[model samples]
Target: MNYFQPKPISNFNATIDIPGSKSITNRALILSALSGKTITLKNILLSDDTQYMIKALRSLGNKIEYNESSKILKIIGNKNPKYDNIDLYIGNAGTAMRFLSSYLATGTGTATLHGNSRMNERPIKDLADSLTQLGVKVEYLNKFGYPPIRITSSGVWATSVKIDGSKSSQYISSILMAAPNFKNPIDISFIGKVVSKPYIHMTLTMMKDFGASFTLKENSINIVPKEYNLSEYLIEGDMSSASYFLAMSLISNSTITLNNFFKNSIQGDSKFLDVLLKMGLTILDFKEYSITVKGTSSYKGIQLSMNDIPDVAQTLAAVALFATTPTKVWDVENMRIKETDRISALKNEISKINGDFIEFKDGFLINPKPLEMYQGDFLETYDDHRMAMSLSLIGLKVPNIKVLDPSCVSKTFPNFFEEFNKIYRED
Candidate 1:
């Protein structure tokens, strides 16, 4: 097994440019393809997840050209293409699996969506059941309520559907994006308190940007059947990716500027910046598209509900180790069904460093420990990208810390370690 040992820095100062948002990128791809018009996407994230979305769209007959050097994509949308028995391997990308499940069902064809071992274990029943309500034929190929499911559909024209949103918000976002293509106007109602509400909002905002008409009520969203119209769009930098570096600056007592980060980001994970402020990090400057932050020698713990921003919850868990008080995070039970059982994974890894972690059903409580008292030889990443990136922050202060399977970061931030290394001032 390959391991990466992060070297501690004595004087940390660097400027980092984070990659594009994965959530926005995948949503834009679907919107662009559904539009059936030539669209140019700038600042697109080129990672395993977005690549899967791009490849799957191409397999479904959408013409897309991506330039890695310039970080741009040219997509000629494919409307109502027909194919039978097509196989798409999503490879642990939860967004692609859920979003494409509805995307494929709205078209006229039969396709099977499957993924890696962990991806197969993640729940898709909420999304599948919602699609089934819209008249799409969904069958469980292996395990019921999971991936490797066969979706056969002539087309869907359902007017109303209700979905259980407690498990994931992607299921709802999936249906919303494809709703415009449905023959009849649709009313989507939620069955429970939706987890990650911000992601759903992001989807709606993007859909409107693409020229889809939608109205938001207290509990339901009504989207009129209309064609999308978008010629060009620019994606913002990923806030979830920025969380790691933000925590890095704090633990290492350094100052770093993140370029292309917006002060007003549509992503929910942007709330992580507020959490950092509570933990003693100072934002020196905040421009429209960039922010400079400086870390402190001491940090404070905080209590917050991460239900709306579960993606960055792991980053907060890593930062908790250096806090003076116990850090309490709750109301994110849906995190269990992510790329891994993130709640359990965080508990297991945090224990290795001798930090006190109390695991609850929904979230965990972390007791702070002094940097000198923390000791661990190796930290296992469990092949989850967020796990690898978040846990690596501990190595900036604690020595002899090695991250196993570090390459797993390619799932989102492919160049995470390269950017992370910039903080280490060479001897």
Candidate 2:
């Protein structure tokens, strides 16, 4: 097992550049492949998840040229691509698994979507049921309502469908991205309160940017059949990836400026800055395309619902270790189904450091402990990227904290440690 030892930094004023959004890159890849027009994407993230997405699109007969050094991608979209049979390994990429499930359903082909053991356990039944409702043939190859499933489609034949949105927003995004390929105009309605509502909005906004005609109401969305049109698109920096460095500022006495982070970012995780601000994090500068933040010597605990920004909830959990009071985060029951059971994982690791963590079905409460009382030689990452990155925060103040399986960060941020190491003093 590869272990990473995070050392405390004495001097940590630095500027860092984060990679493109894994969320946006995967979504853009699907949209570009369906556009039937050559599209250029700039500053796209080159990571395991996106590589899986690009490979799946290529396997579906879309021609794509990627320049890793330059982070540019050129995709030759194929609107009516067809395949006889293909097996795609999604490797725990939730976005790719969910997004591609619908993308494949909009084409004339038979495809099987499978993944690693963890991915196989993640739920895909809600998406499957919705596609089946739209007349797509969906079969559970192994356990019902999970991956290792088969999808055979001539195209979407239904005009309207209702899906349970409480589990994952990816289900809604999956159907929305594939709706334009439906035989008739589609109406999508939600059954319950949709978690991560901002992600659905991001999908609609990007669809409109690609020339899709859609109307979004309070509880339903109407989509018209139209080909996506876009010649060039520039992906924004991943705000979720930026959260670690932002949290780094809060743990250590330092200032960090992150490039390519927009003040008006459409990513839901960008709102993490607001949560940080509430914890006494200061924003030194906020511009259209960049943000500078300074750390505090002490932080205030916060109580709030993180359902909208669940991705950064782990970051907040780590930051809570240094808070003055107990931090309460709830309304993120979906955390149980991510790359790992984040709530349980966070609770387990926090206990190792003498921190008090009260678990709940939806979320947890974290009580701050004295830094001198912090004790733990190693923290298990559970093969989850967020766990590895977020738990490393404890090392910023505590001594000799080693994170096991740090390489798990390759899922979204491959060079997370490399960038994270930049804050250390050369001496």
TM-score of each: 0.98, 0.98
In model 1, what lDDT does residue 367 have? Answer: 93
| Model 2 agreement with the true structure over 276-323: per-residue lDDT tens digits | 988888999998888889988887899999999999999999899888
lDDT tens digits, residue span 147-230, model 1:
899999987888999999999999999999989999988899999888999999889989999999988899999989899998
lDDT of 1: 0.90
lDDT, candidate 2, at 145:
96
Ten residues in sequence with the least summed lDDT for candidate 1: 418-427
